[model samples]
Target: MKRLLALTLALLPTLATAGQITLILSDKIETSDGKICLYENAVKSEQVKVTASAQCRHTMTFED
Candidate 1:
């Protein structure tokens, strides 16, 4: 049982992922000015949520 537990623990990382996060989806909205709004220069370690992953840009927009 102990060996089995150790094996599971050791193989856990292989089963999952490491370093950086997996971006599931993103949001891309068009501005009224006919410009495409994009997400970029996100703060350090920030996560953005979007309804449609395909439309998202996998980035974050910060207010200057």
Candidate 2:
């Protein structure tokens, strides 16, 4: 059981990055507004609950 658990834990990072999801950040939104620090810059991460929008941009990345 320990070996299996260890394997699953090790694989978690790869699985989490496998699925693609876009986190759109905006400055005008009132709810779910926050900042995400990446590299050396701090950018605002906002809530986007709508199914469709024209101003949102897609951010994508992968993990090992």
Leading candidate by TM-score: 2
lDDT of each: 0.47, 0.44
For model 1, residues 20-44, the per-residue Cα lDDT tens digits are 4433223345454333434433333
lDDT of 1 at 6: 100
Which portions of model 2 miss their true places by more than 4 Å?
20-64
- Model 2 has an lDDT value of 0.44
- lDDT score of model 1? 0.47
Among all candidates shown, the one with the greatest lDDT: 1
lDDT of 2 by residue, 1-64 (tens): 9999999999999787675444433333323443332211143333443322333334423221
